[model samples]
Target: MPSLRIACFHLNQLGDLVFSLPALLALGRGFPKAQIISVARPPHRELLLLSGLVHNVVERPRGQLISKLKMVSALRSMKLDLAVLFSTSLGTAILAWMAHPREKAGFGKRGLAYRAEKIGPPSVANNLRLVEALGCRVEKRDYVGLVKLDESVRCRVRDLLMHAGIGESTPYAVISPAASGRRAIKEWTSEGFAAVAERLADDLDLVPVLVGTEADEVVAGLSEKIVDLRGKTSIIELAALLEGAHVFVGIDSGVMHLAAAVGTPVAALFGPTDPAITGPMGEGHKIVQSDVPCLACMKTSCREPLCMQRITPDAVIESVAMCVSEEKNV
Candidate 1:
């Protein structure tokens, strides 16, 4: 076959982009000389830029027909050999078809009309891990890890730690107590996270770093002793920070996936969702969930979130302890 210039489309949120990194890396490895482009959103663009996997990041604009037409025109200009649509949306499939790549690939489900050399249903473990399912020859390798951080980002993180009055050498854990949507029933309460942080500090002598966006500052504010970095770090900076942490504990959010991508040990909380579908991937990660009947509802909103409420701080602390101990043994 000729050298393939591929375009991979994953126009979802941050976590989606993180999980898709391994597959993108595999593609890059398989076709080292080919130009690879990604269609992503704002923060995701920053992520892919930092990831160093794609040759180009095409910003997906927000508008109606005119904007999409412009994007299609751009795709046509690339003269791509292959287009991989990661979503099940008909619109995305249609876009791949209209782009007129020699080969279009995506899930073969729900009557999505597209000509593809490879197609399969979604995998529950990791979306990127699905590359093996595509019938492509994949080495039995540990799923490709996230891209390495540059020294500049690492130095910035060290400065951030110093500004926070945290020593660069001090081992710490990050606690993210906020979740974005109703699918985020996997999030523990602020009080619950505070309790766990307090215990971990007292017992393990590790500082607790609180992380989130500005809207999540209230959650970080609940912890008196935690080093709060909410609303401060960018997506790339957050990944660098996670790289230096000893362990990370968070709800089912983008940060948790970031920690996993950076190879940090993670204790992720799962509620009202299946860990199989969206939990943290790779080794050195543990997931804790409640046995509530209404769990895995996958609903955007819920009136009663007992599944989340029932996951006590003590339980989370225990999971963290286990991950830390395992890491030390290794």
Candidate 2:
């Protein structure tokens, strides 16, 4: 019999794609003989490739209509047995329909064979609902042990740490103070982060290493005492770095999700967004949210985001310390 051919339409944001890992893992376990393919962004494609879940990845289309048409033609030629849309949009639904897959799976009644509706918080469970629509039993819904980092990547991160004055044996905490896109209002203050850095060094004996994209450096900055690694590492390399860290402290961002995926303990600070909807997954993670009445506002921008500003550095230090202690116990 021919191997079952599956195509996963996975064009998603970084955290959203990470949220989809458990469903992908379930797919792999359910049909071990199948050839599963994923269509995702270039960076996300690398992530799925490292997870060892999908057999191959095709770059998600970008730019003009011609590019999308080319992608549609390529997918149609494969005669996919199943096409699952992790990103449930009308446009994506149209693309899946154009591909002419034998069967289709997605959220809502988008002319698909299988459909899943929005569920409760902790969005990982919601992602699994779509796969369950395909008759796959999801025993695990966490990305903790799904993605494996190569030894080479670990060595590279080790070298990077050494250069940054962190030895391989040094206990360190990764701090990401910036949130991507319009979520800037969700960020805790730089002053608060700097104070947390000092506390990590002086009180907990953990070095605070700042990590983010170049665009985030200005927003995530601490003093010269902190080792800033913004724009220095690729996504996979960042994963390796987070994997080796003692703990990760950050706002609600894709970096926090990445840290959780690598099994690092996370001290996530939340304000404008709801933690239950998009917080870090799995165990050994701490969510520190403000007590503001307007919490979980889900607003992209706020002139005075007192919710984030209200979370003091002392609270964060306490959470970080707890995460470290819990990790040590583990």
Candidate 3:
């Protein structure tokens, strides 16, 4: 087989990007001589770089039309042998089509979903299908790739936590209380998170550290029991903190996926999204979700949102206990 040049565009949401790791790793191994160009959004660009799965990571900043066009020009210059799209956006398909690769494959066709009986499968399996189209079958399909942590960053985060009074002997749990702004309905109540954090502190003797971006500050502040590290650490720094966490408790968001990527125990709280589709993609993770009638609706503008409301703090705490207990057993 001749050497191939592969261009894969996977600048999706954080959870979706995490789901693509196994396929990307397999592709790199399947064609060792292939010059794989990975395209992803910020933070994820750092992740792909840390994973060392691609020859180069094409940084695609948000709201940058020129950047996208320039990437297309660069990809066209490569004369790509295969173009794999992990997302189903029309723009992504056009980008793949515009690149004029010898073969193009993706999850579900955006325009063709209506005519087809079924749309995309689970996010993880869907991404693997793109690699499968190129005649490669992955032996281990659940890998999110190995994430390399900078020792300097890890030491720095430890110093920061120590300054915050978290000693080296203290067992800490990471609590990510927010998701995307548009998907607020997917989040559990602030009171529920607070209750869980308090219980974790009081009963388990574990410090709950709230970690997220500025968007997560409100909920992180709601719980006085947690050590709010919101908007402080960079993405890689946050990964280092999660790497040391004994347990990670959060919604169906990217941080949960990140914790799973770093081999941490995750207590994934699900509401609007299906756990089977986007739960923590690793072992020894506990999922806490309600069986509400309107659960898994994937609605952005839900008025009632009982699905999120019904997931009680007790359930979350139990899930946390289960996750940490499994961690202890391991």
Best by TM-score: 2
Tens digit of lDDT per residue, candidate 2, span 266-294?
99999988888888888999999878899
Q: Model 2 reaches what TM-score against the true structure?
A: 0.92
Candidate number that wins on TM-score, 1 or 3: 3
What order do you get sorting by TM-score, best first?
A: 2, 3, 1
Taken over the whole model, the C-alpha lDDT of each candidate is: 0.76, 0.85, 0.79
Q: Report the lDDT tens digits of candidate 3 across residue range 1-330.
A: 667888888856777777778878878877889988887776677767777888887766667789878878888888888877776677778877878888766665443221112244336676666676666767766754366687887998999899888988899999998887877887888778888888999989899898877776666766678898887787778888998999999998878888888899899888888887777777899989887888777667688888888888888888889888888998
Q: Per the 3 Å backbone cut-off, how many clashing residue pairs does candidate 2 have?
A: 0
> 126, model 3: CA deviation in Å?
0.5
**lDDT-better candidate, 1 vs 3:** 3
Candidate 3 error regions (>4 Å): 108-122
lDDT of 1 by residue, 234-309 (tens): 7888988998998999888878878887888999888876677777778888888777898777766677788888
Weakest 10 consecutive residues, lDDT, candidate 2? 215-224
